[model samples]
Target: MINDKSFIHYLKEAEQDFSGWDFSYVTDTGRMAASLLSWSYGSMAKKLITEATSLLDMGTGGGELLAKLQPFPHSVFATEGYKPNFPISKKRLHPLGVTVVEVDEDNLLPFTNGQFDLIINKHEAYSAQEVRRVISENGIFLTQQVGGADCAEINEALGIPLNQEYLHWQLDFAKKELEDNGFRVVFAKEETPVQRFYDVGALVYYLKAIPWQIPDFEMGDYMEQLYGIHRKIESKGYFDVTQERFIIKAEPI
Candidate 1:
């Protein structure tokens, strides 16, 4: 269990950080991204909810999907590994009767095996084996991952190449890992489509959210590049940057 009140403080921090952002031009694009992500969630769990009474959403960012599913009868429990994200996500969904817990990324999940009829990890950290461990037999494992060529436009706009090789590995090796672990694959496909946005600043914010972007790229450099890109954004009115993403669905054996 998490202290929902204490979590409010973290949400405040995130809101403050996000407040400085300029989202004027890209509101539509932002909404599209949210809609697409949320749609992926609905696609994964729709069938399960018709059959089962419980679900677990791993890395339920800002509890967006959980809030969307509130009207459904399933008992939804969520876990977020990042401490900062946990509190903010809790605040977002708690009012809607969603309960989110903090979980250690490397350890066993708090719930026992076969506890949930549906287990989902949308844009969550990867611990393929851990996923195998916690899910109930025949339970669904749904995911939408950062695709191999995600955010290629940012790289192009800034005249730099970001590592997209991992996406290649995700398809090649990750699938085999799941199969060897006794899970049967259901749906797997590459969705290499660009999510359009109007505001260059909002695009910058999403780029900053990436983990590798935090460690390797200097914030000053990124801001400088973003500032330079803003001129183009102003000229064109909006940029339709294509990002590659993968959608995977599986069930435990």
Candidate 2:
């Protein structure tokens, strides 16, 4: 049901300017595109999703997946680190009896131990230790990450290369860190790469829109760089960009 056209509209609406302390542009659009491009969490969690009393939709944005999961026999609590989207999510989930928690990336979540039966995150910055700290012993933690090792391919296609060394090693380190944190890994699958679109203008728009990704980099001057890449890629009708993602499910021990 998700297509490129709908994604464009979602991007446009999500980029709309908002004023407040809860402003996180990248978390908003990034999560949406990640969800639409692939439902890695839903597919991975399908087998494990059973009747639970409560579930936490970590990094919930646009409320799309959370909304879809609302019909289950559980109370859904949505958490978003992006401040601006928190109010928007609250408005949407209030009528549906979902609680919205505004999370701060620098601080631990304001929840007691063993608060949720299921914790899910798609494109979130949480590490395995963080998930293990708050989840109940029997609870499950599901994540769909940006596949740290293979991210360069997509960056090259986007004309924005990340200046990181040993990216793949970092992902492996993360896996080890999670296992060290008392989580037993259940499933770990990497999704096949898929194509995504961003016209020259959209690409430039996104650079400015998601400052968190390239905070120190000056995007204005990069317009030319992006345009050049866009022209070269678009000349062939479409950019052959692809993103590799990882789906992981673990349970606290």
Candidate 3:
């Protein structure tokens, strides 16, 4: 039974609080581990910033990743759609001279056309046309996206179907979308990396944090599946899942 003493004990451990696009509670503590990717977006961004006079960071969650990728260009901006992250990003980025904007739709950017020389997005949804419209002719658009198959193993283990709408979102689809929208892809790569969770609670906490992972996720509804996974983890040491990831670097055609 999931209500057993041991199950409850680990569930309590998984309830540890986290905030601001940060997952250090699990990641830093060794409760969860993800394999590394071949490329580093931060390193690439750092190099590009030196030559860029204007920059935009799309969906800058809590401004944490943006903050890390700084010494920014003269005109730097970040957009976040999530309301709870607005104040958090503002507090962290304002002092750094970034203009944090609240955006409602991925297709409707508030900035004027040809406004930015460098635009970067990490694990964020974006519209190809909107991005092409905003970037200068000589500008660069670099993004790392989570593929439709991201963490599908979790859904499979829980007997849930993968989200159909995003099932075809991968490097090929994104590259074609950009090309059709007047951008030439300069670099693109995709990889499936392994992510291992040491306990069931870590997975619960993760799914809770990322609602889209299991929309309408309720602990009560998933108790049996959770217990099954818990038992598996206890027997196997960890539950492993392959996550889909891809990166694209493009320029206006």
TM-score of each: 0.75, 0.74, 0.97
Report every candidate's CA lDDT.
0.63, 0.61, 0.92
Q: After TM-score superposition, what is the CA distance of residue 137 in candidate 1 from its true location, in Å?
A: 1.5
Between candidates 2 and 3, the lDDT winner: 3
Winner by lDDT = 3
In terms of TM-score, how similar is model 2 to the real structure? 0.74
Q: What is the C-alpha lDDT profile of model 3 across 46-107, one tens digit per residue?
A: 89887899999999989998998878889999999998889999999999999999999999
Best by TM-score: 3
Give candidate 2's whole-model lDDT.
0.61
Point out where model 2 deviates above 4 Å: 1-39, 46-50, 72-74, 149-171, 216-219
Off by over 4 Å in 1: 1-16, 19-39, 72-74, 95-97, 159-169, 211-219
Candidate 1 vs candidate 2: which has greater TM-score? 1
